[model samples]
Target: MELHALLSYTFFLLFLFVIAGETVWANEEDRKVANGGFRPTKLFVFGDSYSDTGNNPKSLASSWKTPYGVTFPGKPAGRYSDGRILTDYVARFMGIKSPLPYQWKKYGENKLQYGINFACGGTGVFDTGNMQPNMSTQIGFLEGLIKQTVYTKRDLDSSLALVTVSGNDYGAYTASGGPEQGLPSFISRVVNQMGINLKRIHDMGVRKVVVTALQPVGCLPKQTIFSSYQQCNETDNSAATLHNQLLQQAVTTLNNSTKGSSFLVLDLFSSFNTVLKNKGDFTGSLKFDTPLKPCCVGKKGDANCGSLDENGKALYTVCNEPGSTFFWDSLHPSEAGWRAVYLTLRSSLNQIYN
Candidate 1:
């Protein structure tokens, strides 16, 4: 082989080695977490699809279909990704198994040690087009448990709460023919309601609450499809900026009013954009071949993430390797993408429990 081809072959070999070894390295990280003596022993989760772990009804949700959980656990586990969603990793960081999904929590009474996940996919801060419970209702589930004394005052004092609201309300707004001119006002309303939700949860006695800033909705494959997934829409990103700005103010005010630093905002927009700009720089162990394109896509533009055919065959095409893709579908990230973003948010996660 020529000199350049020889180097290309060498890099190819190393990439394969990393691919083979990545699973073992991930397992080792989990084992270390098991013995790491983390402070928070429990985690309570709320909000929409990003943090939802099987809370959406499997029979009606596409997330329970094939290939959704093809990576982690080797089967569909109702997470909105190929493998673990944000809930799983956040729980793992705190040295606990992910809390049971709200729809199934009652069945596993003994599994509430890590707190419960009340998040439902495709739902939002307010009631969206779907019938799934909104943010306040999600919190109501936790409050009901508290009222029944399922979690004593000590559990509430020792627990951490995670809140995620990924742009589903805006999506619903557009879908419902709500005009573009009205978006800013609607975003403000969303944040105000979210602030109320945060305060209500805090009042209910959760020790610490973490609210995630909106992810760059423009950067998602749904919006990127207009650019062939090659470029992001800056106008949409600007909207996200405004949303985060107001959210930061709200969170700051909440923390100032509460005892200690009771509220923190996870800067998902900044960290997600950073990951796109400098892929895998923190770990240097994995590389995404196409950061914008999804790992799984329908043959046509209209199909959902894990769509299937009448014959039970896959109607969508999957990339050769999901572990190298940042997105799994039009809306959600692959397991690898969440892992990368978690690594970027390591400092923020540390700030919450410590």
Candidate 2:
């Protein structure tokens, strides 16, 4: 065989091996959960791109473009990242297939009976930069379902809701002449609104709700690219810490006020930090040496990611293996990176599952 053909075959074999190993790992995880005696029936998701599963209108999102879903499912399915996000993993942990995105309603109805995802990319509790639906609007979609009798009160009685408010609101705040000194107040407002949203969902009939604490926003590739993706900016992390603290307190207050501790908080910041600290062991199928580096990036400081000319000429270079890297782009994680975080969250979820 020619050198090129030989190299291609070798790479294919390696890819197959990595996929097989991940399958085994996932199976083991399932067995562990089963033995521990936990089973959850439904998962309802709401948030931004991180948990969005194609809810964004196709014309409005770059996630619908090529290379977004190159790693899994073979095409862009509207996920902000390369593959599954936290919603998919949480659905898996619940022992049910990932529920379809709310936008895919016409595609199937069986999954909708289980649950629906209401997340949209670039959305926040308050209107952010994007014209897409904000958290209130997203919940309005769910409320419409109830009003239309799509999801009956009984359906929601046994359901679980996963709410993610990643930092889009903060991003919007920073861009719109909002003072950095007032970020603490903004954080309070965000959490306060989040608590209201959670209560509304619970009151609407959902049994248990899980809200994710903000991840280490300052550590994302977008913020750390200047550091060559080697070190997290402590300043950013400190800000995130404040946000998480307020969120934790809000969650506790919500639970207490509800007279039942049905609310749960998933700590993404700590989990992401743990994976960053032990990067070697959590290598994805692609065996990336530096998981922090993005797999696809804009060229020459342009604002586009992996852009190409009209003739399809390449304008960006892809990393060696997307699976090996934790981040697929400046703002999101690779599937493997999400999987590692899911593993760490197994215990936290068990609290809700039980």
Predicted model with the maximum lDDT: 1
| Full-model lDDT for every candidate | 0.80, 0.76
* lDDT (Cα, tens digit) per residue for candidate 1, span 44-154: 899988998888988878789887889877788788889887887777666567788878856445668768889999999988978999999999999899988899898
Tell me the tens digit of each residue's lDDT in model 2 across 258-312.
7566788899998888787778334343344686788878776764554678898
TM-score of 2: 0.87
Q: Model 2, stretches more than 4 Å misplaced?
A: 1-28, 31-39, 107-109, 280-288, 310-312
Look at candidate 2 and give me any clashing residue pairs. Answer: none
TM-score per model over all chains: 0.88, 0.87
Model 1 pairs in collision: none
C-alpha RMSD between model 1 and the true structure:
8.8
